[model samples]
Target: MADQGVRTDRLGLLLEQFDQAREMAQVRLTGLGDEEYLWEPVADCWSLRRRGEAVTPRAYGPGEWVLDKGAPDIPASEYAEVARQAAGGMPVSKIAEDWSVSVERVGEVLAFTGTPEPDRTPVTTIAWRLAHLHSCFAGQWEWTFGERRRDPRLLVDFTPRAGLALEAFWATIDRWREDVASVTDEQLDTVGFSQYPYGSDPDDPFIAVVAGSGLEFIHHMAEIALLRDLWRARFPGRG
Candidate 1:
């Protein structure tokens, strides 16, 4: 009975964390406009783009819009090495020979894959960040409650407009909350309760996944809020 009480308390705390994060996110997102949503504070920032405008090797979602996301299996380390070599004025052919990949492949990596270097990481637009946050919640929910599917490409809703995107994100959050609300204490204690493939969810206790999800939400929402403040600072009197 005590164990059951502890589990219930833990679940309740996780749910409350989600509720607080969602409320704060909604407040931060209030009155956001397309211009602010898509604003590029720095050049060549990752953002939501029209279907044909994406420069990434792989983009996601259906409809006329896409997020500038990379393939899940992208060799980020190899791309980072290629980027480092290229930055140091090494010829692509030399880098390719050292890495045993084609010169064209090296060029493709440089063009399509992002560098892991702190200075080279592209600033992401609000739209990109929000889309990422939405995808995280939606993907976990699908794998945890709806289906065991691991493919995020199947989950659409990369809306281009800010208002529509927020609506879609809110809907996802609502669905996730509803699903998680029904999770039993036994489920919380069960390892592999969440089969979310993108992360270590399959090996983690459902309670841990819930806690991690809350942390993810809080950090990303704080980032979005900071970006909003920066935007306001950059362009006085403009949202």
Candidate 2:
């Protein structure tokens, strides 16, 4: 703690909160099979699918932005407006499409952060939600401590299968814990310590980034759990 300025206890508390949220998500995802992982309660309901067709343009309803709304062939104006109105970033499907996951299943959390949301955020599968959590976990760690500076645009294609996705989430968290312990508490007080690209880290303190990430985990983990509850209720026998 040579660089101690703020308080390490604060970081420990943040990690505790982060771990608790992750535990909730893990419990929610327990026993979720392929059917539950990719189940679509509604037509064109967005969920992770068998790579290509499971989450492609062909499956979406008319007027629905293609799953890969950000795809080069699809005009930005098309999905951009949807985001503006939806109060989140581009549609989850669009990000899946860009991942080129034509061979396996995909899952993710909606990018309901800073980006505008879509007019209707499709019901996402557990697989997609897990992927989103883990992906963000990985991205945040890389940017905050690893110096990788991962690009958010590339995340659309970074889908993983179910169990692996969960494992990845913890793996990243573990890595962050090991890496962050040595981060002088004083570093937390310094402005712009995060240096992440997807967020306003350049103008904020490292402590804010740490707290925000913990909140992000808590926020999405609860949402994921709720989706699982709704999914079970929607399909009784499966639940």
The TM-scores, one per candidate, come to: 0.75, 0.62
TM-score of 2: 0.62
Q: Write the per-residue lDDT of candidate 1 for residues 1-239, one digit (tens) a residue.
A: 55565344778878877898889889989989999999988887898888889978677776678888653332565566567768878787766665555877777788874435433356899999899888889889988987676576558668768899899889988988888889898998898898876665776689889899889889888989999999899888985
Off by over 4 Å in 1: 1-8, 71-120
Q: How close is candidate 1 to the true structure, as a TM-score?
A: 0.75
Q: 102, model 2: CA deviation in Å? A: 32
CA lDDT of every candidate: 0.80, 0.57
- Backbone clashes, candidate 2: 16
Give the alpha carbon lDDT tens digit for every residue of 99-172 in model 2: 34321222322232354344445556555555565556666677777666556434333333455545666677
